[model samples]
Target: MENEISSKSTYRLLYRVKPFLAITFLQFGFAGMDVFSKVALNQGVSNYVLVVYRHAIATAVIAPFAVILDKKVRPKMTFSIFTKLMLLSLLEPVIDQNLYYFGLKYTTATFAAAMYNILPAITFLMACVFGLEKVTLKSIHSQAKVVGTVATVAGAMLMTLVKGPVIELIWTKGRNNQGVKGGGTNIHDSIKGSLMITVGCFSWACFIILQAITLKTYPAELSLTAWICLLGTAQGTIVALVMERGKTSVWSIHWDTKFLAALYSGIVCSGLAYYIQGVVMKDRGPVFVTAFNPLSMIIVAVMSSFILAEQMYLGRVIGAIVIVAGLYFVVWGKSKEYKSGSPSTDGQMVQDKQMTDTSSDSNENSTPEVITLNVSSRGGATRDEQINRQSDQLLV
Candidate 1:
């Protein structure tokens, strides 16, 4: 009995922390992708071609599971959903990814990862613009989010504009600078890379927002991920061909870091990450899904210093610290907002149940109905509406 009780306790604990573990593992995978992708790019792998190959591999790996597991749950694909999928592919797989690779080429992996820390801020801003987020000035949580967004942007600028003295680590100390200039040494390259990454973040934010919107009509995470990868592969191939033109050699693959990088990034970052994030977003919402980006930045900073002999600066460190602080503010505010709203949500659910019961009693022949609670008073639907829609669909 004691053993069984202990096993149940363990299971409950794992269930409670599952999302945390999943997102943390995702950060490790993303950090590895940054490091390996940097190495592969250094070894003459074309960023355009890399994007194509990555999506191709992702499609191949993810399609089968999507076909089998999501067969029943997958919604009928409409032209609207198809169009959204195309745009989704374009945003992340083609535009955002290409720009990110170009930025990574100009900047160190650590810098690029640090720059990505602003993703939640970008996502929050976009959500607000789209009416998916409510910004009430009187709310303390809203105030925290606004201040956090500003702090995040300021930190990004500091990281981009200021390159202080190098803070050498034991791994990077006394090492030959490996023919690679520190990201901050060249002002022009830093500006160029920073611009590309910042723009890429916007594209990424758009992708995430659209993804949440798309999931309303198409709720199958696996199938949706497969479609995105397959469509992205097609779109990315066209972009690669145009960019590489006559440079067929850029497509060549060998048993080296280049091929390994493509394989790892495809399966881990593109395929698994998309599916996992989609699942998490259904429950926690988009902002929650992006809140953990700083974890990957921290991982990349340490891994790059040890593995790539990348030099870190005091300014970058300070910026990273500030970014992390801003990220937590956003997360804490979101959490508090959710907690404060839970009682209302519960009350709404009970009211919905009472209405359903009343309708059933009034008409004996009436079929059970699914109630979609539009919790947001704003003009646009929030993630709560999406969740309610998904639940309604499941009931049907």
Candidate 2:
């Protein structure tokens, strides 16, 4: 009896903390991707080539699975949907990713990850500008979000401006730095990299806002991912050809670190990461998924110190702390807004709840997990409601 009680308690605890754990795990995966990508870039792989190979591989791997899984729920691909996917491809896998890789080549993994902290604030600003989100000073929740945005931007600036004394690590203090390419201590390049990363973050913000818009029209996440990868692969190849003009040697990646980097990034980061992200977005929201990005910065900082022998400093520590605090504030505000029944969110939740309720009645013998899985995509289009209107109509 006691063991049964303990088991139930443990299950409850795990359920409560699952979202936090899931996002942390996702961030760790992203950190691994960053490390491997840096290794490839340091081995003289052109940023354009890396993007081309990664997206190309991702498309090949993901396309069949996406098509098979979404065959029933997948709607007809209109030209309009195709155009939006193309735009998404341009914003992310093309411009944003290229700039990010170029900047990463010039900066430490920690610095690159830290610069990503600006993305949430920039996204909020973009959302407001596009009228996707409202900013009312009357609501404490809105005010808190605004303050968090400012603090996050300030923290990023401090990280860029201040380079205090290096804080030596016990394990890496005296290690030979022969293999650590662009590993810290390059102020000029770091500054330039930081600027480039900031611009990349802005583009990433645009991608997120636009993704939210696109999800309204095309709700098949997996299919959309495949198309984006396919388009990005094509675009990246063109850019690579132009940039590496007459240097066909750059495309001939030796079966070495560069090849390994490309393999890992394509399978883990591009393909699996997209599926995981879509699942998380369906369960939580896009804002919730992005709120966890700061975790990657911390992971990269620790890994860079031990693996790459990168030196940390007091300035970075302080800036990281501030950025994390701001992230929490924004998350807190967002949560409050969600709970307070904001019309937009409330309407979405209610409409989705109705669809789930109807579907459950029709598919009475279906398992609870199936219902939850299908209903989690609540933030998306009303077409999802149509998809669920008839339980005879398969739910993917």
Top lDDT hit: 1
- Candidate 1, residues 170-281, lDDT tens digits: the string is 7787874448643445768877988998899889999988987787678788999999999999999998898799998888999999999999999999999999888766
The parts of candidate 1 lying over 4 Å away from their true place are 1-16, 181-184, 342-396
Q: What TM-score, over all chains together, does every model reach?
A: 0.83, 0.82
Which predicted model would earn the best TM-score?
Answer: 1
The residue pairs found clashing in candidate 1 are none
Candidate 2 per-residue lDDT, tens place, 313-336, comes to: 888888888888887887787666
What's the CA RMSD of model 1 in angstroms? Answer: 6.2
| Model 2 lDDT, residue 167, Cα | 81
Residue 375 error, candidate 2, Å: 14
